[model samples]
Target: MIIAIVGATGTGKSDLSVSLARRWGERGLRCEVVNADAMQLYRGMTIGTAKLSIAQRQGVPHHLVDVLDVVDEASVARFQADARAAIDGIIERGAVPMLVGGSGLYLAAVLTDFRFPGTDPELRAHWEAELQRLGPADLHAVLADRDPAAAAAIGPHNGRRIVRALEVGDLTGEPFSAGLAARETPWRPYRQFSLELDRPRLVARLDERVRGMWRDGLLDEVRALLPLGLERGVTASRAIGYAQAIAQLRGELDESEAIAQTQALTRRYARRQVSWFRRDPSIEAMDAAADDLAAQVDRRVAAELVDTMGG
Candidate 1:
């Protein structure tokens, strides 16, 4: 069985995953992490995504991190394949696969047999050209008319996602959300947990985390990746911190302005993440601030695994 560690940003999901793996390892139960964050797939995007360093991983193996260049567009379908393969291998070795991330769609893509509609080169090219000509907001408006729910889930500034949503709607002759109906079957049985933090505390954590990202050389990291064509990369360039940092580099935003924008955007994105995950009734939302959180979560996972794995 697979386990998903999901929630909003700044909720300590990564640390908890490592802790759980370490605890389970003592019982001779091997566990490895599978990356579900879209941006974390890109190499050299360390500081911005708050990825765990080699030593910080605490000897737990992680898959799919840093597997792509900044110029590569991440395909959720591709990630589903890669992550499931990693999980299958871990299971074959009698190890647990921990699927961890805050990206709602990415997490779902891995946990479920979510089928994305096929893309059309001619149709996709037309949408891309229209997106370029009309700009994100206008294109978003067009999407709203055709598939309002999809448009609502995607941000206006996310032109690539908007284009894909429209492309899917056109091909299926149905709203993009149609493919995402309640699933009777997933890849396998899994116990999913979502860590939650109250908004006030979450805001403070986000503020501190944003400052930490800056102090830890987020700007410098972005600068280093620019030579790798991050600026020209459509998908990578729009990453939360990278986009703001790029604006700072181009003199569109000062250092302070960039940091402020990053914090605000991160908080907003966290809300969206939580909202998305909340819609999945299968996920047990854990209160991260609770004193018994770690114990509670570990016990549930241990019991369920024993039962499901026939221990």
Candidate 2:
């Protein structure tokens, strides 16, 4: 059975995954992790992304992390294929595959029968030009008028997603939400667990985490990636903290302003993640702050695995 550990950022998803894998290993059940977070997929984006180092992983094999250069645009369709292939290989070798991250869309694409609509080059180019000319806010306003639900979901700051939503509407003559609305049967048998905390607590944690990123030298990390084409990266360049760091590096925003902006954006992103995952009825929610959370999850997962085997 595939195990999914999903939730908002700073909810200890990574720590939980490592703990679960280590526990399962002790019990003779091998578990390997496959990352679903988009920013974590890019190489050299460690500090801002909260990506675990080799020592922190404790010998657990991880897949799909640091697999792409900063300059490469991350596509959900491509990730879906790559992640599924990794899971298939893990299952073939008699190990449990764990999908772990805050990215709701990437997790859904891998766990469900989500299909991508074809894109037209001309239409994509048109939206890109519009994004450049009108900027994210204006382009987002156009999307809000075309599809209010999509606009609400994508948000005004995310020009990439806004453009895609508009392109999808014009290309398919359907709201972008239509694609996300279909909750078809999953492609594989799986159990999902979501870690959650109260909004006040989560917001505090998120703000502190963003501050910690900068304290841990996020600026230096961005500097390292700049030579690797970070600014040229359509997707990577716009990641919450990375963008702010880049702005600070370019002297556009002062250090305090950049840090504050990143904190605000991170909190906003966490809210959107909560909203997205709450829509999935298949996930079982757990309190992230519970003292025995890992033990509780391990017990539940053990019971589910036995049931799946018997059935």
Candidate 3:
């Protein structure tokens, strides 16, 4: 059986995955961990993304983490394809595949079997040229006219998403939201689980984590990447911590101001993630902050897997 562990950042999803993998291993069940976080795909982005260490993995096999160059544009379609292949391989080997991370859109695309409007190289080129000339807000306005629903769903400040929506509409003659809504869910192949926490406690944890990130030299991480000449819209540059740090480095703000701004943005993102997962009835949510999380998971997973094993 396949299982998914999902939650907002700082919710201890990875810790739970590691604990479960070790428990299942003791039971002589084969399992592998697959990453679903978008930023974790980039190499040299370890600390900023909170990527798993070799020791932290505890010899459990992991797939699809740190597999991309910082400059590479890793699309959701690419992520879906890679994850599908990994899932198939794990099942073929009689192992359980556990997908774990906080990237809501990426997780939704894979679990729902959402198909993008086919890409047109020529059309994509045209849109890229137009984006360069017109800038993001103008392009976003155009998309708002063509696909108001998509425009509403995507933040206007998120230029990459705005550009993508316009490009998809140009290629498919349909809105991006329409394509997403039309797709059927494919998660029947897996049993999904979600990690949740008390709202006040979660917010407090998020604040503390952001402060810890700053103390751990998040600015230095961004400074190291600055020499790479990374562009503004690349996925890594837009990461919650990286974006604010870059602004500070560029003299747009002081370090204290940057930290405050980054923390605020992260808090907002976490709220959205919580809302998204809450809407999905399929997720079996568990209190991640509880002292007995492993016991709770064990009870639930045992019941579900009993049926899978036909016992």
Candidate 4:
């Protein structure tokens, strides 16, 4: 059985996961945390991403956090593949895999056994060249013409998806959306849960968290990472805190304005998370702010594990 704790940034997902993992360990049930947040994957992004420290991990092993260089791109498809392998390893060791973090798409990809279209190296190279000259909007327009359904499904601002769709279409001689639709589930069935909080309370918590991040040198962390020279919209630079901090560093905004903007963005992101997770019926949603959250999750997981053992 897998317990996935998911919510927007600063929603106590990590804290809850850590507490649960430690609790399970005391119960002689081995447990490990597998990161599902995209931003937390990068090295040197600790404070901004609220990555768990070794001490905070409380000797419970964690997977996929701080495992990538800032320059490397960690895709949702890559995360799904790696996380599945990690889950299998944990289960083999008689351990429960606890999927944790706020990256809804990443969690969905793993939990639903969603398969992504395969990339063509040659086609990717060609598109890379074209992207330099044609720009993202042009590429997105091309995708819109070829696969309007896919274009509508993907965020217009998401250049990576737009480029991948066009590349897949060019390589396979079929619509990119068609390729995605043809993909198959790549994982065995697993039980999952989603941690939720009241919208107003979540937003208020996000505001406080963002303020704390600024006070705790989130700006400095971003500044330290700027020398890595990652381009805008690249995986690392596009992270929520990094993007807003870069604006301040670039003289586009002052410190106060940057903090305010970052807080607003975080609140908006939390809202989007609520919307996304609400659509998935498979997610056993529970109010994470409740005092008895761990007990509730334990009961849910214990019941499911009993059924799995019986089967």
TM-scores for candidates 1 onward, in order? 0.96, 0.95, 0.88, 0.84
Give the Cα-based TM-score of candidate 4 against the true structure.
0.84
- Writing each residue's lDDT as its tens digit, candidate 3 over 1-311 gives 66889988889988889898888789877679889999888876776688889999998899999788767887888999998889888777777788899887788777776777677778777777877888877877888888987776564566777778887887777788775563346654666678888888888988888888889888887777777654433788888888888888889989889888878988888887787677567788888877867667777777776566444
RMSD of each: 1.4, 1.6, 2.7, 3.3
Give candidate 3 regions above 4 Å deviation: 121-149, 182-184, 228-233, 306-311
lDDT of 1: 0.87
Best prediction by lDDT = 2
Lowest summed lDDT across 10 adjacent residues in model 3 is found at 179-188
Pairs clashing within candidate 1: none
Which residue ranges in model 2 land beyond 4 Å of their true spot? Answer: 307-311
| Candidate 4 lDDT tens digits, 1-311 | 67788866776888888888877678677788999998888888987788889999989899998878888888888998898899889888877888998777788777665667678888888877777778777877777888986775554556776778788787778786663342244355665667777778878878888888889998888877777764443788777777878888889989888888888877777776777666556667777778967777887677666455343
Residue pairs with colliding backbones in model 3 are none
Rank all candidate structures by their TM-score, best first, as comma-separated numbers: 1, 2, 3, 4
Q: Is candidate 2 or candidate 4 better by lDDT?
A: 2
lDDT of each residue in 1-311, candidate 2, tens digit only: 89999999999999999999998889888889999999999999999999999999999999999999999999989999999999999988888899999988889889988778899899999999999999999999999999998887777888888888888899999998786765457879888999999999999999999989999999999999999999999999999999999999999999999999999999989999999889789999999999867799888879877565442
- Identify the superior model by TM-score, candidate 3 or candidate 4: 3
Name every residue pair that clashes in candidate 4: none
